[model samples]
Target: MSGPGDVLDLIRERRAFTRGDVLEITGMSRMTVATRIDALLEAGLIIESGTEKVAAGRPSRRLEFNTGHAFVIAANVDTTHTTVALTDLAGRVAAEERIEVAVADGPDVTLNAIADRAKHLLADGRIGREDVAAIALSIPGPVDPDTDRPSQPPIMPGWDAYPIPDHLKAALDVPVLVSNDADAAALGEQRVAHPGSRALCFIKVSSGIGTGIVLGGKAYRGTDGGAGDIGHVKIAGHGDLLCQCGARGCLAAAASGRAVARALVDLGKPTASASDVGVYLADGDPDAARLTQAAGRVIGEVVATMVSLLNPSEVVLGGVLASPPLLAGVRETLYPRSLPRATRHLSISQSTLGEKATAVGLAAMVVEREYSASAVNAALARS
Candidate 1:
C-alpha cells in the first residue's frame, strides 16, 4: 500500500511535485495520494510551495522536501587537522570550525576534542540537541563496515578497531556514522559537482594516497571497507623507500605528498607534512611544483589501471596536493596509458569543494541514511 514514506521518496527526488504528479507516477488513487501527502506534511517532512498550473483544473499546490526540519553534525579527521560542521538536512553548512588535533593522538583524546567542539557549535547556533538527527565522521583510514572501527590504518596508530561509532554515540547520544575520507570526498564531489556522472573516481593525494569510487550515485565501499586503499599498491623500482605500513615500493612511498615532503626536507626545505607541501605549492615553489608533478605522473600510472577497469566518467583530484601541477601530471600519464574508450568520456579536474568536501559528504551520508524510506516508515509507525 502507498504510504507517507513512499510519497516522500518521490517528492525528495524531484524539485517540486504535486498530488497529480504523485498519482500519475505511483498509479495510486487520488485519496491515497492525498492521505500520504497530508501525513508527510503533518510530520514536517515536506512543505507546500506556491502552486503549479494544471491543464484542466485549478492550480495544484507544489510540494518540496523540507530541508530545515532537522540538522546533522559532520566532521572530517585528517592526519594533522580536523574540521567540524553543523549542516542542514540538504548538506548545507550552517556553521563550521577547524582544529589542529592530530589523529595520532589516539581515538579517545581526539574524539573527545571533536565532541566538545561539536557541542559548542550547536550551542552557538542555538540548535537544540533533539533537533540533531545524526552525527557523521570521515577519517583518513579504512573503516570496518561490521564493526564501525578503523581497520588497521597505516597512519592512524592505535586506532585499529577502536569502536569509533560507539564512543561518539555515547558522547552525543545520537546515531553515529563513520566513513573513509576519500570515500566521503568522492561522494561530495559527485553529489555537488558532477551529479550527472554515473561513475566517478576521486584520488586523494594527501599525506598518503587513497582512492574513492562512486557508482550509480552511491559510494562503493568494498567488503571489509578496504576497497580504496590504493596507496599501499606497490610501485616497481622503488623498493628502497619503505612505507609506513612496513612495505617497500608502495605507491604512497614513491609518489605521495609525504614522499614529496621527504624529498623537500632532504633538499634543505623546511617542510614536514603534506599540508606544508601544500603551502609550498601555493607559494609557487619550483621544487614543490616539480616534485608534485612528478608524483602526479606516478599516481597517474596507477590511476590508468583504475580508469581501464572502472571506466569512470569523471576523476577528481582532491586532498592537500590537488593542484595544477598534479592535475597536469596525471593527465600526462593517464591519457596515454588508458585505452581510448576508457578515456573518451573521462574528465579529470581538481576538487571543487576543497577542504570542506569531506564534511559536506559526511552530512549527505547521514541524511541519506536517516531519512531513507524504511527509516521514515519506522519513525512514522512509532509516531
Candidate 2:
C-alpha cells in the first residue's frame, strides 16, 4: 500500500483524484485510501464532486480541484489600457474587465482606475472579499523586487518611487505583488505555455521594446530588477531620435512600436500607433513594411547580442507587432549575427499566450504562491 505521504504527493502532482482511482493508482488498501481522502476533505485541500462508477457497486464519488476555495486578481497595466481579471485556483477567469485608462498619467490616477476595475470585476464575478487570496499586478516598468514598488518608471512620468504594492494592498485589502510587464508576460508564457522548460526569453515589441529573461525556471530580474531593459541600449549612428527615457538613439527610440509610428509619420504617412503599423503591414504597404523590417533588424541585432551571451533555449516573440515580417527580420539578422552554437539550438517562435500572457502570468503567480502553498501545507498535514 502507498503511504499517506505518497497519496498526498499523487493528489498534489496530478491535481485531483478519486477514492477508487487513488486506490488503484497508488495500490493502497481501501481503508487507508478512505482515511487519507477524509483527512484531505476535512482539511479543505480537496473537494467531492458527486460520483462515478466502479464494478457492480452503487457508484464511486468523483473529485476535482475546488476552485471556489480561493481566488486571485490579476491586472495587466499598459500605457494605453489596463486589463483586470478574477481567476480561481484552476486558472479560469471567472470575470474580466478592460478599461481604456492610460497608466502614464501617474501612479495615483492609474492605480485608482485599476482598483475600481478590480472591485467591479470582483463584484461582477460574485467573489467575496475574504475569498481573494492575492493580487498580482504587472506594470510597464521596472519593479524593485524587495520592496515590490515601481522604480524610475521612465515612460510613466510620475510613477517614480511609487509604492505600488502598498497602494494596491490598501485599496483592495489583499496582498499585492508587482512585477515588470514583460517579465510577467514571460513568466506567464513559461507557466501556461512552456511548462518545465528553462532558459527562455520573451521579447515584447509593443509601444516599447523590452526583454524578459528566465533562467533555470525563474525570472531573472538582475541587480535591481532592471536586467532586461534592452530598450535603452544605444544603436550606432542613429543619434537623432529621442526616446521617452530622454536617451537618444536608444533601441526603443529606433525600433519600438512608437518608433515605427514616428517613422511612418516622418515618411508622410497618416498612422498613429504601432497597431496601425500592424494593419498597414498586413495590407502590404511598402512604407510600413520597410519601417517594420528596419525596426525588426535593429531589435534583432540587440537580441543577437543577448543570444550570444545567454544562449537561451528558446526566444519567444510577443506583443502587438510580433508578425511574420518582424520575426523574419529578427531571424534574418539573428542567424547571421549570433554565434554558431547559440544559433544552432535557438528556437524563435511567436508568443502562444498572445495578449493574455501578462494577465495569465499574474494569475499564475498568485495561484502558485497562494493556493499552492495552502494546498501543499494542507496535504502535508494530512499526511
**Residue-by-residue lDDT tens digits, candidate 2, 247-334:** 7999999899898988898889987887888788778888887778788888999999999999988889998888787888898898
Q: Write the per-residue lDDT of candidate 1 for residues 115-197, one digit (tens) a residue.
A: 99888987765788889988888999998878778988988989999998889988998889999999999988888899888
- Segments of candidate 2 deviating more than 4 angstroms: 1-68, 372-383
For model 2, the run of ten residues with the poorest summed lDDT: 1-10
TM-score of each: 0.95, 0.84
* C-alpha positional error of residue 165 in candidate 1 after TM-score superposition, expressed in Å: 1.2
Worst 10 residues of 1 by lDDT: 7-16
In Å, residue 82's CA in model 2 sits off its true spot by: 1.0
Q: Show the colliding residue pairs in model 2.
A: none
Best by lDDT: 1
Segments in model 1 whose C-alpha atoms lie over 4 Å from true places: 52-60
Question: What is the clash count for each candidate, in the order shown?
Answer: 0, 0
lDDT of predicted model 2: 0.80
